[model samples]
Target: MSEVNAEIARFDLLVDAAWPAPGRAEDGGWVYRHAGGVTKRANSVLPLGERADLPEAVDRAERFYAGIGQPCVFSVGMGASPGLDDELGRRGYRLVDPTLVMTSPISGDEAAVGAAVEDRPSERWLRTWWSVDGGRHRDTGEGPARTWGERILGGVPAGYVLLEEGAVGRGVPQGRWLGIYCMAVEPHARRRGLGAAVLRTLLAWGWQCGADSAYLVVTEANGGARALYEREGFAVAGRYHYRVRS
Candidate 1:
């Protein structure tokens, strides 16, 4: 594979290291992941190879997520088979969450705000994360959401970063790369450079941890986020879209 193709192929492994999946299975060349059905990404299928057995793999993935009471989702990336995405579309799977995976070299820059990095998320950090991403109240029972934020995130060697009056982020440094996840800044905190500060803080942390590069995923339509990351020297490394059964 070419260099770009190799990165696309290895993308899922990198993400799995960052956002852990507590419940996982493999069929044919597909990786089926579920974290108590909390998030769609965790419960999605990653087709790593193009093979004659792909149909069987799809069947197994569908059944696996169905057993857990979640819709079957497939994350289609650049290196996937040429017709695989079209096949899913023909199968009544609507496209959702077109996302871009962006990457950049670690920079030695100062953060606008002091970011508190922790091995475990404090109650405040968790609350902040859920507030922006979760529609329900933070006090909602420790169901799949908690399992995802606490168990899955805690499973890896992670840095949960909370910025004062600004932003929240997570970083997982493994090997030569650091994966940034769950970055959010409050609406009122926008345009004050808090987002860039949160990102720079993570990159600084990654550099301190001996990471040479950093990567993050963002929704394709999030223009503000894309622009912010671009200003921080990140470029689109690859793209993926989810296919959910209709």
Candidate 2:
């Protein structure tokens, strides 16, 4: 595979490892993921390569997700089947949440006093992660937030760094590389260098864990996050998007 394809494949692995799905299988050049009734990333089809029976594949995807009470969704990346996005578009699937995957060299920094990095997420880290990501809704409603939280935050065998009064992030290692995820700062904590601090801590941890390169994914519309990653030497290595039939 080319560099972009390799990076994107690695990113997809990281996503699967980090988010996790209780029910996962493969068919027709696609990876089907289902996690009860939680987030799209954990319950979507990943079209990785070309296949002869894409229509049957789409039907299978629809049935699989519908069996689990979820609308069908597909993750299309740079390495996905050519024209898959257009095919989905023609099938009434609308595009959503375009994301950029970025990579950079790992450079250690001084660890902050309040920063806590661990192989598993702490209670505070879990709460902070969901609060900033999309966990707050379950606070009042009868949503499956806890289940989603458990799968999203508890499945990774990687570093979970939480900075009290600062920020929170995750770093999952795959071979000599680490992929960072869930890096978030509270609204009150913005513009205080805490975001950079969270990244610095993850880099230090990745380096200590023998990682040479580190990567992270951010939505294409998140300019502040893009700027921050760029300042840390990260560049856009690949991109992906979700197409859903709701």
Candidate 3:
């Protein structure tokens, strides 16, 4: 692999460790993950390395998710096996959530502002996050999905940040890399700089924890968030999307 591809693979590994699923299986180089269908990141397959029998591996992944009563989804990133995405597309899997992985260096100059970082997510923090992001799926209601989401959050050690003004975010520092997740601002709190404050607080916390760089994933459809991350000096480091069979 080239240097760029190797870097993408490193990020992929960091992302997997940062956001873990309770139910996990391995098929060849593909990881079959399921966490009550709460989030695509937790439910989808991460196809890394190579598979000698690609078709059989794909069929097994489909059956694995079918057994769990969820759609078979594959996360296609730069590090995915060659031609796996096209094969899934030919198998009638539609694409979704073309997401950009943005990254920036933590300069240790970010101010914490009004946000507070906690060792674990509080009820208010989870409430704010679910309120903003829970409607992504028809079955992702706050009650049961919240239980599953909490499990995923606790799977790894990380810092959870909540802004007093109704914004929330999470940061997972691995070595010198910080993976940011669960950034959200309440509808009533838009345009008040709370989201940026929460992001800055997380960056500050990550830097204090010895992380020199930070990364986060955002869908291409979210223009407001893309703008915020760009202003924070995060550039597109890689791209990934999910192919889901309905």
Candidate 4:
């Protein structure tokens, strides 16, 4: 709830939501799965000490991944123990991107949320988001679009995608709570207050559905986003990183 950084924030969320991969080590730490998304991280604070690879621990991760046949995403951040990077690397896993974590409470009024993404606007908005993402994500399928879309699709936790839309904007809510996972207004759509409207709609959806709190994450470097969220009344809650295996 405090304004912690991304690492701490992610750790807490993972502990609360992610399901650990089986063959958990009794010593501590675990592989987690949430909503069908699989990732590996330390649950409780564990020791990397001087010696990074503890036979039992290394073996557990390898065996678990072998069983699942999926790449276990390792979110490396502040709470991460030493040698984890090296240990996992030696085993052939790589570190991924270290994305920022951000949050804010709902604020502002008069905006509306449109539930069930409208065929025209929703597509437009998502397409813009895709464009903004550029070569970073291959949603366009020309390569960038295809690659990015696949990355996101792959990264999504199972139960979450299987359960909810995770889209928030003015006037949309299926339940008491709505998650604003990807909130992007088209560059052409910017400054028109669509973002604010989206937030309002998301809150409305939540309230209408009976949700108590609304939350989201952003990176510190995202100046425009941070400003918008701040103006809208969302405060920095914490940060977390989704370290891509290198």
- What lDDT tens digits, residue by residue, belong to model 3 across residues 80-158? 9887988998999999999999999999999888456899999999999999988764544324777888899999999
| Model 1 TM-score, 2 decimals | 0.90
Candidate 2 lDDT over residue span 75-131, tens digit each:
887767777777889999999999998989876553544566888887888777777
**Error of model 1, residue 7, in angstroms:** 2.1
* Candidate 2 global TM-score: 0.89
1-246, model 4: which lDDT tens digit per residue?
234544353544443332232223333553333222312332121232233445566566545644645444555454555566666677666544334444434443325544443312344444554555433422221234333342443332321111022222322222333345556565655776667666666565455455555565566668888888778767665554443334
lDDT of 1 by residue, 1-246 (tens): 688687776777788667767878877667788776666677688777666765656677788877777789988887665577877887899999999999999766635356667888888888778777765323223365664657777878888788768578898988889999988887777789877887888888888899998889999999999999999999998888899999
lDDT for predicted candidate 3 compared with the true structure? 0.89
Compute the lDDT of residue 181 as modeled in candidate 1: 91
Candidate 4, residue 89: the lDDT equals 73
Poorest 10 consecutive residues by lDDT, candidate 3: 136-145
Of candidates 4 and 1, the better by lDDT: 1
State the TM-score for model 3: 0.96
Report clashes for each candidate as comma-separated counts. 0, 0, 0, 50
Model 4 RMSD in angstroms: 8.3
Sort all candidates by TM-score, best to worst. 3, 1, 2, 4
TM-scores for every predicted model: 0.90, 0.89, 0.96, 0.52
Please tell me which model should have the higher TM-score, number 2 or number 4: 2
